[model samples]
Target chain A: MGSNDLQKQAPNIVVWVLLLALPLWLPYVGGYMELGSRVVVLALAAMALNFLLGYTGVLSFGHAAYFGLGAYGAGMTIRYLVPSTGVGLLVGTLVGAVAGAIIGPMIIRLRGVYFAMVTIAFAQVFYFIAFRWNSVTGGDDGLTGWTRLPIHLGFTTIDILHNPVAFYFLVLAVFAVAVGVMAWLLRSPFGRTLIAIRENERRARFLGIPVDQHIWISWTISCAVVSVAGALYALLNNFVDPRALYWTQSGDFVIMAVLGGMRSFWGPLIGAAIFVVLQDYLSSQTENWMSFVGLFFVLVVMFFPRGILGIIRRKVAS
Target chain B: MTQVVLFNVFNGLIVGAFYALMALGLSLIMNLSGVINFAHGGFLAIGGYLAFTLMPYVGFWGGLVLAPILTAVLGLIVERVLVRRLYGRDPLYSLLLTFGLAFMFEDGTRFIWGAQSLPYQVPGWLLSPLSSDYFFLTGYRLFMVVIVALAVAGLFYILNRTRLGMRIRAGTLDLETVSVLGVNVRVLRNMNFGLGIYLAGLAGVLAVGQLGLQPTIGSSLIMPSFVAIIVGGLGSLPGTLLGGLLIGVASGVTTVFFPSATEAVMYVMMAAVLLVRPRGLLGEEGRF
Candidate 1:
């Protein structure tokens, strides 16, 4: 058991090292700072989704609603209400978390595909709002004319707006805090209950755990974190649109989590990284990139449903 | 004021019928097989596009009969080659597979037919309103409703009376029992899938005459179909049909007072249904 623990820690350490040194090494490998930042932001969203999907075993295909809310919240705050980036993030996260909590009750009783189907259907409400409420949401053209402000500390100011490297670190720092909290929670008793529920709901229910409540809590946490990622996505692009909340975007996030291997903690992050880079390359290469992306989904489900990390873990176990 | 309300409500009923048409097909596949066919909208698009290609050669009526058949044939092949493997596995794999297929279908249609929306011409006589006072009552709209009504009646007749329909109904109720009775479960699922796809194709042919043809035409209608199934009740075709119309009328009414919320109304209805009746308006208990 001690040896196994050490082995797990070793890979985690290597992963951290790679992530930490990404911005410094990325430019040398033909990757820009913004690309690195995009990956971190998207990976954070995927990881957040995996908390509910991979860990709690709740399948939510409409996470993009909260994610879009976060983006719109942050963007709207920065554009209309407040000019501070920190406040934008706070408001964005709050909006997403609150919405998830409110919507939780309606979907908690549903399990498996029904839950997913309802979630996807509900997400369209937000998409329509964003698309139709043009006066406030800027309609289908997307929210524009707003840019992320530079961070102002007590002693120093970080020009994240101008400096791509600074923005990458800022995203990485938030990712670290959010991912750390999730990892810590997973090791706690409450987290164990979640895992139990995921493994077998009936057994967990028999063990006197309140299954629905745990799932609701897990779902809210996942949404909150994904919203934070959404806020970051808006900050990175300095724009938010109805497309951000579209059902297709939700599918993309699911593919990221599945492609990364839902069982492993860092799997979604890796999945996000590969997906982002591949999508970037594909869009640049062909007009029919959507088909290729769709093909990727088919191929992944058919051949690598276990994901990259899953296959690696299997090899090691063998 | 009455005329405006009547116009939207009447419009809503027509739209609702279209939703019912699509939802019935989706519900059939989801009921018999545990897989939710996310690519259903894609098949609808294929149906519409196929009709468009064939119309120039076979005329509008000929294309109407043949296009859905072609779409169902394609659907049968897909069920056999791709979807069949995932039936015994987790529902997630099938959803993902179909989601991918949907993207392929949409992109494929866009690749074949230009992304620009194509005009589908109906007969000139059907283009004009039946009466001046009820100018909203175009001959085309009436024809579509009549055709849909006939198709739905045909579907129910087949389901209640025909051998294949009985097998499908039995499979949906208890596949294990049907298999125990020496029914080939694989062939049953494949045929059921083809039947559902056939409905989608029919919807495509009917819909394009009114809404026109575009790669995204099917996608726009799909969420409402899901809502329809949910609102009507899971595992109940009558419920799906009812749910589609209810939301359609709901949206149409809302359009009079709150035009912006035309699309959002159905989601609101879905939420209310889930809250008041989680099983749905007509859904069976323990089906989900």
Candidate 2:
């Protein structure tokens, strides 16, 4: 029983070990600290999406709206309201979460393609606002002139602004907490019910679960976590743009979730790592990288729908 | 003030016609195949580009006639090769596949044609204003509306009177029963996809004449089409048509007043429609 339990925990342990050592090995592989931070941030977003998509059986093609909102919230807060990084992050998260909660009731009853279409359409509202609201959002130029502030823990200051390693660590720390909460939620009874709904919604409804309400809660939670990732993303770049809220950006998160193995806990992380590295490499290599990335999506959907982890699990099981 | 309103409303109707054309294609595919076809806009771009490429050889009318047919052929091939494999699987795979195709289509168009927006030339006669007072009512704009009306009329006629159209409608309601009744469901779906792409192609050709030709043109237009579908009601084609025109007029009117809110007004209308009727103004209940 103990050995079996260890086997189940093996992927989690490996994932944590690799994430912790990313900054150390990344440079050796011709990658940078910022790249590592990006992988983690994107992985968090993908996993948050997978919580509702893979676990709850709901798909949101508009998650980038909350993500963009979180980024803009953090950026604007730092640029206009407060220079404190922590406060900006908090406010950014609240803004995204609140928006998600409000939008939840409007879309929760929709299923499948209709749900996706509405989410994509709803996200455009935010995108256009960011694009057209020139005075506040900096219009097409994006929010600029604001940098992520250093942390002052009373006795000492962590100069994350100047040091890439400090910023990477800070990102990792937030990622760990957010991932931990998601893991905990998935293991709880609430998570089990979510999985039940995923497997068969009609059966779950017959079993007396408040399916729509649960989905709404799951959707809200996923949006909040994704918003946290968005906040970190803004701080990492110290900028925010409307492209972050575009529907294509949401597609990226979904691709990461699918590429990693949406069914597994650590799958999206693996997907994010591969995707970020590939994108970084491809974009550097050519201007036609969008075509290649699009081609990659097609290939993955056609041949690798089970994802890296899913394929591995099947091989092991066989 | 009334003249300005009239001008904007006329402009809105033209824009709404384009939206309705695209939305009708999208609605057809969504209803029959249960696939949202995120690459619909990409296909539209292809149609426009094809028309542009064919213009030097065939002239304007010839390009219009041939571009949509060629685009429909491509659509048929795409459905057979890529989209057909995932019909029974989760809808997520198909959505992702088409989303990728959209990226490819946009990038492909950019690579083939320059990224710079190109002029789609209409005949000199078509460029002139119809009246001295209402300069906005150009001959080309009027022609576009007429073509849209004819195309829409033809589409309804095909769906209501043709055997293939009957099969499509029947399949949409119950695919299993239709297949059991010996209908070639695969062929039905493939042809349905082709028909839908034909409309997108037509919209693309018409759109370039008004908006000019750009790689991002399809993506820009796709969202409003989605809005049109949602506002029209999911299962009903007529509802989609109404939804498209309503939003177009709403945005046009908004342009007359709050210029900045022109793009946002349709979304506002959509939100209102969803909040009050959820199924949409013309949408049938339980269709989604």
Candidate 3:
């Protein structure tokens, strides 16, 4: 990230301490932190999307396809070939990037609803492949009976997944580092190009920016980053379903993106937290919980067009 | 083989009528306002539930008529308050706004009607029109086809010939010019939005006799509506009908042969269409 951005982040570095320390207090906090861990991972993914969408005007409706694919890559790897979390992660990201590359060529041709529709279509295609290609992907029931790696340095073994605290710390570390990278990217000249692309593609094209390529690269990296969240979600949930790859999953991601206020990275994080909390709270109370949730969505989209965090930040800045 | 083909073709036409009923309003709205009414299916779902509620008093026929009326009124309010604000905003805002409205309407109906699919019976006249050894067809579907055909013809006549049709065409071509010509643009817009929504509601009413109305049907229907529009070409009325018919027939035929591929059929069709013609089968340049 740029020096100015780094300086700006310095004041918020206490958040890093809190996130890292959550694992230490996990023995006390327990289930809450586990959910918190999942939320943070999703938030990180949404943050990446906000970078592409809010900053660059590229709204990806099929992002969950990449996410589910990455999760499948990790889970499938552990189930069959390699068992290292790090390698699984690398492999998952590679699969995501590869998928993004394949999808990217046609995506730049669409903008607005057309682009969104194409993403939805691609996500559905991926989901169908995952479902219909039953022998390889395990189909509807999903690939289960997989194992998580035990952390060891060739001397002693500690089952990382067994200890929620260790897993929490791992997620926090990864999330923080990813966010840091995103912060840096946003401050770079390339980030300016993304912003310029978002504001006016015609102008950027006039200014000699490889506009389509910029969109292509931004979308690809966005998918790659979001894939990390997918992998983590699978690891956290201990299972993956075609549902994870469904267009509805993409809808949820869009909801979180809009709810968090897409203007900033932290907005998505906060939005993700609120979304998870509300989901848990509402579902626990009533089966008709979607009604409340739907109303909440309507109110948010209508009254607070900038989203919850956007309103708060506006107030603070003013 | 002929029987199977004929059966599938008849089935496709029956279902195509429903698709036409669902998509025609969306095409009309997109024509008048430069906005895509993503909530089209949600209104359909509302009509289904509203029909379900009116079953005891209105009977199926009366309920069918009432649903569209109520929905059109709802459409007017929505256009006046919500959609009008988005006149000059980015199309994304319209997409998201309509999406949000769809969610609210669907879930609100669910809150009142519950999430379970409500049971519905076809009216007596249409319930037992035909039963045969090789083929059995629900008379209600045929009835829906006839009803939708009438609606389509009526809409086509109005849009192509009426005095109001000229204004709508003018507005679609350039709303600013129509406004400058001293037309009551706001009233026309509200009427247009209401008219479009009425069609969606009417489609929903007709649909209840064929399929049970559930909480999530709106989400299910939205994609196909999109596929129809995309294939037919956005904002093109005739295109919407053709697109709807092609998709309905194709997907229905595919389902008979390959049941498992039914869900992915629309996307497959869309992809193939894009490969052959990126502007859709009937889409013109600069429509987006």
Top candidate on TM-score is 2
Q: Estimate each model's TM-score.
A: 0.99, 0.99, 0.91
* A227-275: candidate 1 lDDT, tens digit per residue: 9999999999999999999999999899999999999999998999999
Could you tell me which residue pairs clash in candidate 2? B233-B283
Q: Which ten residues in a row have the lowest lDDT in candidate 1 chain B?
A: B87-96
Winner on lDDT between 1 and 2 is: 2
lDDT of 2 at B16: 97
> Which parts of model 3 have CA positions greater than 4 angstroms off?
A1-7, A11-14, A24-31, A80-84, A129-143, A155-158, B129-134
- Residue pairs with backbone atoms closer than 3 Å in model 1 (clashes): B233-B283
Q: Write candidate 2's Cα lDDT for B112-147 as tens digits.
A: 998999989989999999899998989999999999
- lDDT by residue (B1-288, candidate 3, tens digit) is 677867777777777777877888887787787677768888988888888788789888789889889988988998998888877766656766776677677778777877788888767868774778444476877778888989999888877899777788789888999999999998888888888888888888888777677877777776677778777877678888998888888877877888778657877887787777777877888776
Across residues B40-75, which tens digit of lDDT does each residue of candidate 1 receive?
A: 999999999999999889998999999999999999
The 10-residue segment with the lowest total lDDT in model 3 chain B: B129-138
Q: What is the TM-score of chain B in candidate 3?
A: 0.94
Candidate 1 residue-wise lDDT at A309: 92
Q: Is the docking of candidate 2 incorrect, acceptable, medium or high quality?
A: high
> What C-alpha RMSD does candidate 1 show over the true interface residues after superposing them?
0.6
Local lDDT at A231 for model 2: 96
